[model samples]
Target: MASSMLAPAVGDIAKEFRASDKAALAGQTSFVCMLGIGPLFLAPMSETFGRRKVFVVNSAMFTLLQIPTALSPNIASFIAFRALSGFFGSVGVANGGGSIFDMFDVHERAPVLGFYLTAPLVAPSIGPLLGSVIVRSLDWRWIFWCMCMLAAFVTTFIYFFLYETNPVAILQARKSELQKKHPDVEYEVEGASDESIPKKIMNASDLTCSPENGTRAVKILTTQPIVLILSSYQALIFASMYSLFATYTDIWSQPPYNFTTIQTGLAFLGPVVGFVTMSTLVILYIDSIYNYVARKNDDDGLPEYRLVFANIGAVLLPISLFMFGWTVEMGLAWPVPLVATVLFGASQVSIFNPVQTYYIDAYAKHAASALAAGAFLRSMIGGVVPLFVGQMCVFPSTSTRRF
Candidate 1:
C-alpha cells in the first residue's frame, strides 16, 4: 500500500494515464503469482548454479530493477517496472530461509528469524514512514531512488560476505584448495561427480518436474497444517490491522478532531510504538525462555515451547481489540482509542514472532516452501484489506465493526 499509495498520485501526474487502478492491482497480482511460480524453476536452478551465485547475482539484479520503476514514464511503464522488481527480487526472499538453516542450527535460529520477521513488517511500515516524509519533503521519485540505493548497499554487502554454504560446493572448494597446497596429494574427498549428472537429473525430474508438480502442491497443501491454520489466522490478523488503519481516521477526524492526511498517517505512530515495544519484549524474552526450556528439558531444545509465547500473544490480541473497539464506539477521548491501538500493535508482535518461528521449526526441511506459501496468503490480505478500510466507519452496521 505504501509503495502504491503514491501510485494514485503517479497516475495523476499524467492526465492520459488510464492504467493506474488496473496497473497497481496487476502489479500486486503479478508479485503474488510470480512468488508462487518462481520456486518451481528457481529451486531447481539452485542445484545447477549454486546458492551463493544465485542469491548474490539475483539480489543485485532485483535491486537494480527498482531504478527503472523509479524512472518510469507512464502507467504501463510503472506496472511493468514494479512487476520486474518483484520477479528478480523473489529469488532472495524465496531462498533466504533455506540460507538461514544452512548458516544456523535449530537452537540458534531464534535471532535470525526474528530479524527476518521484523524486516517485512517493520520495513514496510518504516519504508512508508520515510517515503511519506520524503514525498512530503521532496518528490515521490525519491522513494524509488532510496529503495534502489538501499538495494545496492545490500547487494554490495552480500558480495562481500555471502558464500557457498552448500555442503557439496564447500567440500569441492576445500578439495581444490588442498590440491593447490599438495601437488601430488591423491586423497579423494568424497564428492558428487559430473558423471552422475544424468542420474541426478532423473531424480530431480521425478521430484519437481511438471508431471509431479500438481500432486506435490496438493500433497503439501493437505499435509501442512501450520501452513493452512497459522497462515489463515495471520491473514485475518492482518485484515483486522488494516481495517483499523482505514477506520482510525473516521473516529479521529470527527467533532473538532478532523485531521489532515498527514495527521492521520502520523496517527500510525502509536501503533508503531506498540509494535516496537512488543517486538522488543518478545525478542528479548524468547531467547531467555528458549535457554530456560533447553536447560529444563535437559537440552533437547524442543520447538513446542515457543507456543507459551504464542498464548501470551493470543490473550493480548483479543484484549487489545476489545479495548480499541469499545473505546471508539463509546466516543471515549481520542487518547483512549489511540492507546488501545498501540496495545494492539504490541499484542500482535508479541504473538507474531514465535508462531512464525514455530511454523518454521515444525516444517524445518521444507521451511522455505511453507514460508513462501504463508507469505503469499498473508500478502494477499495486506493488499486487499485497504480496499475495505475506506468503508468501515460510514456503515451503520457497527461503529466499531471494522475490527
Candidate 2:
C-alpha cells in the first residue's frame, strides 16, 4: 500500500519539491525496492527469531518511520523515509505464508491463503484510490499521516494478538523450559542431541542466530528451478501491474477522459471489485478442487494441482491487457477500459493465490524462505518498471505490445 499510495499525488509532490518527473517517481521506487529487499533478510530472520518477534519489532519501526515520511521536506528525504518504512513494513509479506503453513494442513491451505493474500494483492489498488481522495481534499502529506494512523493501529493489533508460529522456535522454547525445571537432566530439541552443558548452550545459540538460516531464501532462489521459473513469471506480471498503476493518473487526468481526481480514484473500483469477487470465489472452491484432484490421484495432492486456476489467469491476462490497451488507445468509453481492468484484477488473484499456495506446499518447512524468494524478484521488477512507464506511455501501442 505504501509503495503506490503517493502515486496519485506525484504531480503535486513534484511541484512542491521542485522535482523532475523521474525524481518524483523515485518516491514510489525507493519504497518498493526496499520492500523486495527486506524479505531477503527478514524472512530468514523470522525463521531464526520466530515470526511473532519479527512482526512486532518490524511493525513498530514501520509505524515510527511514517512520521518522518509525513514530514519530509524534500523528495530525497521523502524517498529515504519511504524506503526505510518499506523495509520494516515487509514483515507480513516476508513471513505470512510460512506462518499460515505452520497453522494449516495442505488440504486446508488454499482458502485460508486466498483470504490472507487479499491484503497485499488488493491493497495496492486501493492505496491510489484513497490517495487521490486525500490529495484532493487535504495536503499530499496527509496521505502519510493517514498511513501512520493505520500502521499504528495494525502495530497494536499485531502486538496484542499475534503469536509465535514457528514449530522449531516453539520446540526450542519448550526444551529451554524443561531444562530450567530440571537442571540436572539434559534436554534436546528434535534434531539435536544431548551433550555437555557448555556445548548445549553453544548449539542453542547457533540454532537461533545461524548465518545459514539468514541466507536460506537467497540460496533457494538461486538453486531451485521451480522457484526460479515461477518467480520470474510472477515478476513479469508484477512489473506490468505497477507500470499500469504508475500510468493511471497520466491516462485518466488528460483530455480524452478528463476525469476528476475522485472519479479517477473511483475508476479503481473496477479492479477492487474484481479482486474481491475472484478472491471470494477462489476461497470457496480452491480447497474443493485440490481435494477432488487428490482423490483422483489416490489421495496424493501434488503442488501442480494448485496451478489449475493459474491456467485461467494465464488465458485472461493477455486478453485483458490487449483489451485495456486497445480500448484506451482507440479513445473508447471510460467504462470499456475499466472493464478491462476488472478482468486484469481477476487474473492477478487467480495467478497469485495458486503460485503462493504451491510455494507453501512444496516447501512446507521453508515456506517463508520460498515466498521471500518469489517476492524479491517480483517486487524488484515491479518497483523498477514503473520508473520507465512514462517513457513507455509515449508510444502506447508499442508499450502495450512490449508488455
Candidate 3:
C-alpha cells in the first residue's frame, strides 16, 4: 500500500515543483500503470526464480528504492524510481498464489487466495486514508519512509520461511545428485550437457517440468481463454475500486455530505469495512466449499469447480452496483450504500480467490504463463479507468443516468 501511494504522493510534490501535470501522477488508476505492471514482472519471475527469492529480493529493492526516491529532487527521477519500486513490489501479486501453494495443498487454497487478494483491494483505499493524515501534518516525503519501515517484516519472512516450492527444480536437484552418486543412472532429463556449474544451475532455474516438454511460454499465454475471462473480471472489479477512489473527494464533498478534506478521505472507511469483512468470509468458508465439492465428486476435482463460486459472485456485482447507486442517489440512509459496498467488497474477494486459485489449479505446470496472461490485462484495466472518474462523478450525464 505504501509503495503504491508513493508515486501519486510524489507527483503531488512534482506539481509544486512545476515538473509535470496531473497526467504524470499515473500510478494505480488502471491495470497498466507503473504499479500495475508490478504483477506482470512478478508472474514471469516467480516461474524462473521461485516465489520466495523473488519476494525477498524484490521487496528489499522496493523498500530501498524508497530511500533514493526520498531524495529525488526532480519529477522524472521520482517517477523512474517509483516505477522501479512498484515493479519490484509486485511480488505480492505475482507470487502470492505460489506462496499459498507452497504451504497448502489444493484442498486449502480457497481461503489463502482470499487472504492474498485483500491487500491489493485494501491498499489503494488505505494508502490514501493514512497518507492524507501524514501528508497533511507531516509531509509527502514520509510516505516513502513509512514504506521502508513496513517492508522489513515482508523481507524477513521471505528469508525465513518462503522456501523453494517449484516442483521441477526440486526434482532436478535430486536427479543431479543421483547421477553423480551412480554415474550410470539413466534418466530422460534434457540439457544433460557438460556445462559449467552456473549454466547447470541456470538450466534448473529455467524450470520446466521436464525438458522434452520444451515449448515457448509465449504460445501458452496467448491461447488461454480462461485467463482472458478471469483477467477481464479482475480488471473490471479493480477498475470499480480505483474509480471510486479517483474521485472520492468530489463525490462526497457535495451538498449532502459536505465532508472536509479529512472527512472525505475518511469516507473510505466504509469500503475498508467491505474489504476486511469479505476477506474474513473467504478465509473462513471458501475452502470448506472447495473440499465438499471435490469430495462429492470422488476427490477428482477439475479447476472448473472453483467457478461455481465465481458464477454467484458475478450475479452479485450488478445488484450491489444498482443498490449502491440507488440508495446514494435517493438520499436513503447512508448505511444502505455502506452496507452495499461491504457486500460488493465481499463479492469481489469471493470471486478473486476462486479465480486465482483455479488459475493455479488449471496450470500447475505453467502457472507463470497463466498468471502473467491475466496480470497483463487486469492491470491495464485497473490503471486506465481512474483517469476519468473525477469527471464521471460531476458529469450530469453519468451521475443522473438511471439503471
Candidate 4:
C-alpha cells in the first residue's frame, strides 16, 4: 500500500525536489527493483535461519527504513531509503506463499490463496486512490509519513501474532528439546547427524557460503521451461499495471479532462472494483473447477487444470489493452478509460492466481526458489518498464503529450 502511494505523488515530489518526472519516478522504480531483488537473498536466508526470525527482523528493518524516506530532504535520499525499505519489506512477498502452503492442505489453498493474492495486486490500485486525497490535503512528505505509521503498527502486530510456521524449523526445535531431556539416547536429524548449537550455526554459515543454492536458482531460471515462460508472461502483466499507475496521474491532470489531485485518485476506483469483483468470483468458483476437472480425469487432479481461468484471462488481456489505448489516445468519454482499467484489473486476477498456484504444486519442495525467480523477473520488468512508459505513450500528432 505504501509502495503504491508514490505513483500518485510523483508529480508533487518532482515539483518540490526540483527533479524531472523520470528522476522522481526513480524513487519508485528503485524501490521496486530492490523489492524484487531482496527476495532472492532473503528466501535462502529463511531456509537457513527460519522464516519467523527472518520475517520479524526484516519487518523491523522495513519500519525503520521508512523513517528516512519520510524525512528525506532531497529526491536522492528518498530514492535510496525507499530502495532500502523495499529490500526489507520484500521478505513477505517472497515467503508469503510458502507460509500459506505450510499451513493449509492443497484442497484448501485455492480460496485462501485467492484472498492472499488479491491483496497485494489490488493494493497498488487502491493506494493511488487514497494518495491523491493525501497529496491534495498535505505536502508530498506526509504520504511517506503515513506509510511509516502503518508499517510500525504492522511490525508490532506481527511480532506478537506471527509464529514460526516452517515445519522443518518446528521439528528442529522439538528435536533440540528432546535431546536435552535424553542426552544419552541418540536422536538423529534426517540426512545428517545431530550437531551441537554452535556446530549447527557454523554449518549454516558454511551453507550460506556454498554455491549450491545460487546454482539452483540460476538452473531453475535457465533450464525449467514452464518456469521461464510463466515468469516472462507474468512480468509483462505486472509491467502493464505499473505502466498504468505511473502514467495515469500525469494523463488525468492534463487538457481535455483536467482533473484535480483528489479527482485523479478517485479515478482508480474503477480498477479497484474490477480487482475485487474478479477475485471474489474466482475464490467462489476456482475450487469447483478443479473438482470438476479432477472427476473427469478419474478422481485425479492435475496442475494443468488451473490454467482454464488463465486462458480466459489470456483472451481478455489483449482486448482490454487495445480498448485502453484507443480510448485514451482519442480522448474519448471519461468513463471509457475507466472501464478499460476495470477490464485490465480483472484480467490480472484471472492470470496471476493459477500461475502462482501451479508453480507451488509443481515444485513443492523447491517452491521458494521457483517463486523467487519469478518475482525477480516480474519486478525487474515492472521497475524498468515505467522508465520508458512516458516516451512510449506519446503520439506525435497529439498536442500536450505530457505523460
- Give the alpha carbon lDDT tens digit for every residue of 189-292 in model 1: 45444436565445433454242231233245456785677767777776677556445545565643456546655666777787777777776778778778
Q: Which candidate would rank higher by TM-score, 2 or 3?
A: 2
Per-residue alpha-carbon lDDT of candidate 2 for residues 104-128, written as tens digits (9 for 90 to 100): 9987888999999988878999999
| TM-score of every candidate | 0.76, 0.92, 0.81, 0.92
* Ranking of all predicted structures according to lDDT, beginning with the best and ending with the worst: 2, 4, 3, 1
Clashes of each: 0, 0, 11, 0
lDDT of 3 by residue, 1-403 (tens): 7533533353467575675434445534322365455654465555554566667888888778879877777766766776677677766766776666666777777676777778877776677777777776778778778877788777877788767776654555677788899998675444234457565445544546443221223335456666776788888987787666666555565645566656755666776787787678667877777767889999677888877777767887888878877776765555677777767776776677678778878887556556655666666677677766655564233334323
By lDDT, is 1 or 4 better? Answer: 4
Question: In model 2, what is the error at residue 130, expressed in angstroms?
Answer: 0.9
lDDT of 1: 0.62
lDDT of each: 0.62, 0.85, 0.65, 0.80
Better of 1 and 4 by TM-score: 4
Clashing pairs in 4: none
lDDT of 2 at 357: 93
lDDT of 2 at 304: 84
Of 3 and 4, which scores higher on lDDT?
Answer: 4
| True-structure lDDT of candidate 4 | 0.80
